[model samples]
Each structure stands twice: as C-alpha cells, then as structure tokens.
Target: MQASHTLAELEAVLGEQVKKLRLSRNVDQTLLAERAGISRRALQNLEAGTGSSVASLLSVVRALGREDWLSLLAPATTINPLTMVRARRERQRATSVRAKSPTAK
Candidate 1:
C-alpha cells in the first residue's frame, strides 16, 4: 500500500530541494524571484518550507533555468504486482488460443 504525506511536508521537501539547487548554482533568491515575476515573500515562503503550489515552484524553477528537474521530481507510481501477474497470465492464455499454426519452417 502507498503512504501519503501532508502538503506541508511535501512542500518542505521541495523547498529544501530548491534551496540546495539554488545555492549550488550560486544564485540568490531575490534575483530568482524577480525573474519569476513573484514577490520575494513568496520565494521566502518556498525557502522557509511553507506549502505552495507547484506552479509557484515551477515559476521559480524556470526563472532559475532549472525546469529540467521537473521530470525528475515527478511522484513515484506504485504497481500492483499481483494484478500485473494475473493480467500477464490471462494475456498468455489468450495468446495461446489465438496462435496461428506454425508456418512451413
């Protein structure tokens, strides 16, 4: 089963990621916020680990030219292995029934 976390916690994690990326890139938050067209206060909220919209983060990310990381940060998808195994078995059975006679080899 999958577990869930609060928006606040998720935001905190994202904020930390942003702070690390920004510092690693040697850019200050003010310049980043200005380029993103957001108030410095909003940027501060992000850095301070307050819950904010993904759009807000994306705006800052684009402003910082770090938009490439979005794909990397997508939520992980869970798989039901039992259901998949059943489906695979069903498909194999169907395939066996639908199989054509072997052509002259």
Candidate 2:
C-alpha cells in the first residue's frame, strides 16, 4: 500500500482483501456474518468498505480466523539499550557551584 493512500482508499482495499479471503475459504456473506454474530448488512458494509464499527470489523476478522492481524496494529515494544543507559545516567539532583571569596592580603 502506498503511504499516500487516502483513508477511504485504504478502507476499500481492506474490504476487498476481506472479501477475497472469505471467497478463498468458500464462505458466503450470510454464513460469515452469522458466524461473526453480526448482521449480514454489517458484513456487507465492511466488505463494501462503506463503513463499519471497530467491533464489527474485529468480529468478522475473528470469525475468519485472522485475529493475528490485530496484533500487527499493536506489536510488543522493544526497549533500546542506548535509551535505557541514558535514562539510567540522568542526574537525580542539582548542585550549585560556590563562588570563590577575595584572597586576604
């Protein structure tokens, strides 16, 4: 997918992909919608890329046995060793420098 793709375009692509997956599995919209616990219209909306709730999308994806796709949206974070070291070396308190007094004659 191009980085410049509009939201609508992306949605349409996603809907098309879902439709393709369903077709590959030989599942019809009615059966898939029933398995997903959503209305056939909801599935149609999702597959048509018209619009659908996140819940409906997730339900459909789960019904299709593709829940792993959701993990891609929020992969586990990995901490950088350099960032960790810098954080550990940060100063905990401030110290003021003392001014030298005039020397006695």
Candidate 3:
C-alpha cells in the first residue's frame, strides 16, 4: 500500500505467492488452469495479478479449493454511495469539532 511501490512488484509478489501455494499443494499450472476453467495464459496473468478479471480470479481461487476467498475480498454489496457520503460527512464534522475544542495533549 505504500505510494512508492510499483505495479510490477505487486504482480511479482502475487505471482510468487501463487507459485508457492501451488507447489506446496503439488499442483501444476496446467492442471490448476484446467480446474479453474481458464486458459493457461489467463492463469499466468492471474497469478501475476496483472490485467486479470474478477471472474477469472474467482475461478482460480475456487480451483485452489478456496471458494469463499473472493467473497471475503469483495463481500456482497451492502453499503450504498449515499450511506458512504453520510459517513464521510459525519467524520468531517467530528474532526472540525475536535479542532475547535481545547485539548489536554
């Protein structure tokens, strides 16, 4: 999450993780791709986490027997934009109130 981190680094780290997990489970990339219902190229890109689709990611996770992984990453939508805006406004108001108050610290 650091601003200085490059996209290539992120992709490389993700690719490495996927590779590690796969090798640990003794799963080959070709077999993993087949189980994920994706092409080998798509699997490669996904493990790299670069220019990959949500659907493809989900498929790969499921192939890894982690069906709930995607849901955990992006749970079923609940909060609406209006609610988010209201929350932001409340935080801003609290911050302004604090700024106006005398503090012991």
Candidate 4:
C-alpha cells in the first residue's frame, strides 16, 4: 500500500524490520544489545517501538552490519541555485527595511 502512516506507525514498522533482521541473522536480543553497547532493555524497547535514542539505533544498525542504512536516513544535501538566489534577495529586502525603520532615541 502507498498510504501514508503516522509517526508511531512508522516507528513500529522500523522496529519490526530490526527484529526480523536480527532473527534472520540468528542473533539474540542480549547478544545484539551487547554488541551494540546498549542494554537489553533498550533493545527490547526499540523492538517494541516505545522509545530509543538515535545513538542506540545507529549502534544496533552497525552491530547488524548495516551501516549503509545511515545514508538512507540522511541523504547528501545539494545546493539549489534558484533557492540560493531567492534567499539572497530576501536578505537584501530585510536589510533595506531595517535601515529605513526609525530608531527610538
């Protein structure tokens, strides 16, 4: 389905994927947590979609030999010439306005 989901739903989906990946690799939760340098409870919480820190998530993904996933989370930013021009013009307008505003003595 191409339907959009809530943030909680997205987290739940990610948690399930992590759990499945761990199982497919024959890794137990305790072992995975130890390898990720996190507590077993943290892993559990992550799998349950309750809560998790970004560091913890990265650790777990790395422990699973999936560091490449980080790229998917944050793609490289590229400059847009049009946007840059628009921002520059906007800044110039703002500077002119401040210069013309009467100062309070």
Candidate 5:
C-alpha cells in the first residue's frame, strides 16, 4: 500500500480484503459474526469500511483464520548494535570531586 493513501482509503482497502476473504471461505456475514462473537451489523460495518472497533476487527480476523496477519503490525523488537556499543563505552557512575565549603578554608 502507498504511504500517501488517506486513512479512509486504507480502511476501504482493508474492508475489501476482508470481504473477499469471507466470500472465498463461503462464509456469510451472519455466520462470520457468530463465529467471531460480534454482531452481524459490526461485520457489515467492517466490510463496508464505515468504522469498527479494534476488538471487532481482531475477532473477525481471528474467526477468518487471518490472525497471523495482525502480527505484521507489530514485529519483534531487536536491540540496536550501535546503541549497545555506545552504552558499553559510557560511564555508569559519576566520580567528580566535590568542592570544599568556604567555612572549611
């Protein structure tokens, strides 16, 4: 998908994909909604790209056997080698000498 696309455009594309998947599986809105534990209207809204809750979207995708696709939204975190090297080179504690008070002089 193009980064330049608007949010609505992206939502429409996602809705189309979900609708296609459901059709391919021979599942109707009611049946899919039932399996997903969501209302049929919720499924319709999702398929129509009107709007949907994240919970509803996840439920429908899980019911459609596409939960794996959600993982792409948040991949595993990897440590940065440059950051690790810099951390190793940095001092862990301050060791500066304190100034003597005027009264001590």
Candidate 6:
C-alpha cells in the first residue's frame, strides 16, 4: 500500500481498528493486556499507536487472535524456479566473507 501520509497516521488507523476489533470481541483493555502478557500501559500505547515494540504488537495481536495479521506483514517465502536451479548448480558446503575489498587483490 502507498504511504501518502505520515507513520503516525497509519499508527492511529491501526489503533482504531484494533480498538474496534477488541470491542467486537467483547474484550476489555485490562483483560486483553493480561492475555497479551503485557502491562496495561503497553496495551494503551499500542492502541494509541504512539509507539511500541514489535514484541508488544505481536503479543497484542496474538491475544486478539489475529495471528493472520502477522502474515500480512511477512508472507511465506516462495523461490523462483530459475534462481533455485542456479543455486543448486552452484551449491557450496560453506561460504565466508572477505575482510578486504576485491580491488585490494
């Protein structure tokens, strides 16, 4: 999705949506926070979209039974057939990083 607005706007929108979801589920902030294994303040911060840790967000999502939302952020991996074939052909037991630039050689 295009971000035409600021991150704060997005956070607010998310917070509102979460609030609606919680209401629909007939859950209170205290109960939700307890289920999420976080402090009430943290839950409040999340719902406000002010700023919170990824772990806190995840906990809240889980508590709300919205694990599907996580998939929206990070979908399952899929490999391109051509790239997979190339990788198989050039497979190595191990790889290491070079300390210096190739030009130094």
Model 5 score (lDDT)? 0.93
Off by over 4 Å in 5: 89-105
Tens-place lDDT digits, model 5, residues 1-105? 899999888888999999999999999999999999999999998998889989999999999999888989998789999988887866779999999998996
lDDT for model 6 comes to 0.88
Best by lDDT: 2
Better of 3 and 4 by lDDT: 4
The residue-by-residue lDDT of candidate 2 on 1-105, one tens digit each, is 899999889889989999999999999999999999999999999989999899999999999999998999899889999989887866888999977778843
Q: Which pairs of residues clash in candidate 3, taking residues 3 or more apart in a chain or in different chains?
A: none
Stretches > 4 Å off in candidate 6? 88-105
Q: Model 5, 45: alpha-carbon shift in Å?
A: 0.6
Model 3: per-residue Cα lDDT at residue 38 = 94
Using TM-score as the yardstick, the better of models 1 and 4 is 4
Residue-wise C-alpha lDDT for candidate 6, range 15-96, written one tens digit per residue: 8888889999999999999999999999888889898788988898999999999899889989889888777765556688
TM-score of each: 0.60, 0.81, 0.56, 0.70, 0.80, 0.76
Q: Over all chains combined, what TM-score does candidate 6 have?
A: 0.76
TM-score of model 5 vs. true structure: 0.80
Alpha-carbon shift of residue 7 in model 5 (angstroms): 1.2
lDDT of each: 0.79, 0.94, 0.77, 0.88, 0.93, 0.88
The Cα error of candidate 3 at residue 47, in Å, is: 2.8
Cα error of candidate 5 at position 68, Å: 1.1
lDDT of 3 by residue, 9-104 (tens): 776676676677888899999999998899999988877767677677778777788676557757898879898887773343333344544665
Task: For residue 104, give model 2's deviation from the true position in Å.
Answer: 18
**Top candidate, metric TM-score:** 2
